[model samples]
Target: MTKILISIVGPTAIGKTALSIKLAQHFNTEIISADSRQFFKEMTVGTAVPSTEELNTTKHHFIQHISIKDNYSVGDFERDAISKIESIHKNNDIAIMVGGSGLYVKAVTKGLDHFPDVDKHIRTELNKRLINEGIETLQKQLKSLDFKAYQSIAIDNPQRIIRALEVCIGSGQPYSSFLTKTEKTRPFKVVTIGLSAVRSIIYDRINQRVDIMVNEGLIEEAKELLPNKHLNALNTVGYKELFNYFEGEWTLDFAISEIKKNTRRFAKRQLTWFKKDETIQWFDYTTDINNIINYLEKQS
Candidate 1:
C-alpha cells in the first residue's frame, strides 16, 4: 500500500480544524499541526487553537507542545514534523497535516536549505540595528538583495526581515538564492487539499472570528504572555495588538482594529504563497465532508 500524507491548508478561520478532524476520523489517523503560531503552549486562545472538545475528536501532534521562550525555527519544525509523520506512518498508512501557516507547510513538504548557522554576535547586532535604525532599513536591504522574497514576505514584519538578512550576511549569499527551485522529494506521497471560499466571505469570517476571539478571552491570553512579548511566538497578530494596547501605545479600539487588519493581510499573504503551488486541489468550504473524503479515497 502507498503511504499517504494529506495536507490541509488555507487562511485562518476558514474551517481548517473542523475539516481536518473529519478527515482524520475518516482516515483513522492523527493530525500534525503546521501552524507556526499554534505551537506555543502560552498562545492558546490568542492563537485560536482548537478547543478541548475539538481536540478530543481526534489526536493531534505539534499543537501547543512548546514554550514561547523556546528558540524554534522552520528547520526545527521540519526535522521534528518529519520524524512525527514517520512515527505516525509506522502504524497508520495515512497521516494528516493541517494548518494555515504557509511557510511551515512548505518547510515540511519541501525541505529547507541548510543555510549556514548565524552567529550570536551577528544576531545581537542585527537586533540592535532593528531597534535603533528601524526595520525599514533592513527591509530596504532585503529588497535590494532578494526582490522576490521581499515581494512575498510581510514587509511590516521586522523578524522576517531580520532573519532574511541574517541568512544573507551569514552565508554571503542572497537568501533567495537558497530557495532552490528544485523540489525536495518526500518518502511518502502527498495529497494537498485546500479549503477555499468566496474572498469576501473569507474576510468576513476572519473579522467575525477576531471579534469572537476577543470575546473568548484573547485579551486575557495576551495578558498572560505579555511579559514575554519579545518572544517570536508573541510577535503574532492577536498578541502583538494587545501588547501595544497594554503598553498604552494604542487604544483598545485601535488595537482590535489593527488585529483585524493584520489578520486579513496575513490571509492575503497565505493565499499568495499557497496559490503558487499548483499541486493543491481546492474545495469550497461549503462542500460536504463526504465529498472531500471520497476525493481522497479515490486518490488512495
Candidate 2:
C-alpha cells in the first residue's frame, strides 16, 4: 500500500482541527500540526491550541513542542515536519497534517522555494527603515521593485513586506523571481483538503473564537509573556494587541476588538494564499466527514 499524507488546511476558526482529529482517529494514525502559532509552549489560549481533551483524543506532534524564545523559522518547521511524516508513514499507510498556515503546508506537500543568500545588512537596513520611515516606505519600494509580490503578499504585514523588500534589494531582482514553481519529489503521495465557508460565516466564527480566547484567560497569558513581546513569535495578532493594552496604548476592550479584526484579516490572507493552489480538494466547512473519507479512499 502507498503511504499518503492527508493535509487539512483552511482559515482560522474554520474547523480544521476538529476534522484533522477525526480523520486521524479514523485512520488510526498520528497527526502533525503545521500551525506556526501553536508551536510555542508559552502561547496556548491566544493560539487556540487543541484543547487538552481534543489532544488526548489522538496523538499529535509539533503542538507546543518549542519555546517562544526559539527562533523557529518556516525552514526549520519544513525539515522537522518532513522527518515526522516519514516516521509516521513507516507504521501507517496514512497520516494527517493540519493547520491554517498555508506556507507550512506547501512546504511539506511541495517544497520551500530556494532563494539566494541575501546580505545580512539588507534586513537590518529594512528594519531600521521600517522603524524610522514606517512600513509605507518599504511597501512603496516593494511595489516599485516587485509589483506581483506587492499584489499577492499581505501588504499590511511588516514582516512579509520587509522580507520581500530585502530579497528584492539584496538580489537586485524581484522577490517573486526567486519562486521556483516546481514541486520536490516525495516518497509518499499528498492529498490536500481545504475547508471553506462564506465570508460572513468566517467572520462570525472568528469573532466568537476571539471571545472564547479572551474568556479563557488570553489576557493573562499575554501578561505572562509581556517581557518577551519583542520576540517574533509574540508579534502576532492576539498577543500584540494585548501587549499594546498593557503599554496603555489601548483599553482592554479595544484591544480585544483589535484581536477580532486582525484575526479576520489573517483569515482573509490565508484564503488568498490557499486559493492560488489548484490541487487542493475544497469542501464546505460543514461537509460531512464520510464524504471526505470516501473521496480520500477513492484517491488513495
Candidate 3:
C-alpha cells in the first residue's frame, strides 16, 4: 500500500497544531514536527509547543526532543524524520507533518541541498566578528557577497546570518549557489496543506499569542535560559527580546512589543517561503477540519 504524508504548514499562531491534531486523529497516525524553535526542551512556552492534552491526544515526534546545548541541523532532522516516517508507515499508511519552519519541512519532503564542509575556523571567525563588530557589519558583508541569500534569510537573527556568511566565505561561492534547484524524491506521496489569513488577522493572532506566552511565564523560562543566550538555539525572537529586557537593553514593555513585531515579521517570511511552492493547497485558518480530512482521504 502506498503511504501518504500530510504536511501542515502556516504562520505561527495560525492553528497549525490544532489542525495537525485533528488530522492525526482522523488518520489514527502520528505527527512529525518540523518546527526548529520547539526542538529545545527548555524553551517551551515561547515555542508554543502542543499542550500536554494535545500531546496525549496524538503521538508527536521531535517536539522538545533535544536540549539547547545539542547541535542539531536541518540535515540531521531530515535523516531522523525520514527514519521515523518509514517506521510509522510500517503500521499506518498516513502520517502528518506540521510546523511553521519552511526549511525543515522542505528538508524532509525534498532532500537537503549538498554543501561542501566548511573549515570550523571559518565559523569561529564569523562568530567572533558577530560579537566584536555587531551583526550589521556581517549583514552588510553578506549583502555584498550574496544578495539573494541575504534577502531570504532572517536578517535580525544573528545565527542565520552567520551561518549563511560562513558558507559563502568558506566555499568561495554564493551561498544560494549551493541550494540545489532539484528536490529529492520520497517514497510516500506528499500532500502539503497551508493555513493562512488576512494580514491584519495574522498580526492580531501573533500579538495575542505573545501575550499568552508572557502570561504563561515566558519571562521566567527565558530567564532560566538566559545564561545560555549565546547558544544558537536562543537566537530566536521571543527569547532574544526577553534577553534584551533582562540585560537592561530594552524595557520590558519594549521587549514585549519587539517580540510581537518580530514574530509578525517571521510569519510574513514564512508565508512568503511557502507561497513560492505551487504544490501546496492553501486554506483559511478557520477552514473546517473535515474538509481537509476529506481531501486527504481522497488522496489516499
Model number with the top TM-score: 3
What does candidate 1's lDDT look like per residue over 144-181, in tens digits?
Answer: 88888788777777778888888888888888777775
What total of clashing residue pairs does each candidate reach?
A: 0, 0, 0
Q: Compared with the true structure, what per-residue lDDT tens digits does model 2 show for residues 1-300?
A: 989999999899999999999898899999999998899999999999999999999999999999988878788999999999999988999989999887788889999899888998998888788767977988999999999999988887787888888889889989999888788999899999899999999999999999999889999999999999766688799998999999999999999999999999999999988999899999999999999999999978
TM-score of each: 0.96, 0.95, 0.98
Native-to-model Cα distance after best TM-score fit, residue 58 in candidate 2, in Å: 1.4
Root mean square deviation (Cα) for candidate 1: 1.4
Candidate 3 local accuracy as lDDT?
0.91
Q: Show the colliding residue pairs in model 2.
A: none
How would you encode candidate 3's per-residue C-alpha lDDT over 209-274 as one tens digit per residue? 999999999999999999998887888899989999999999999999999999999999999999
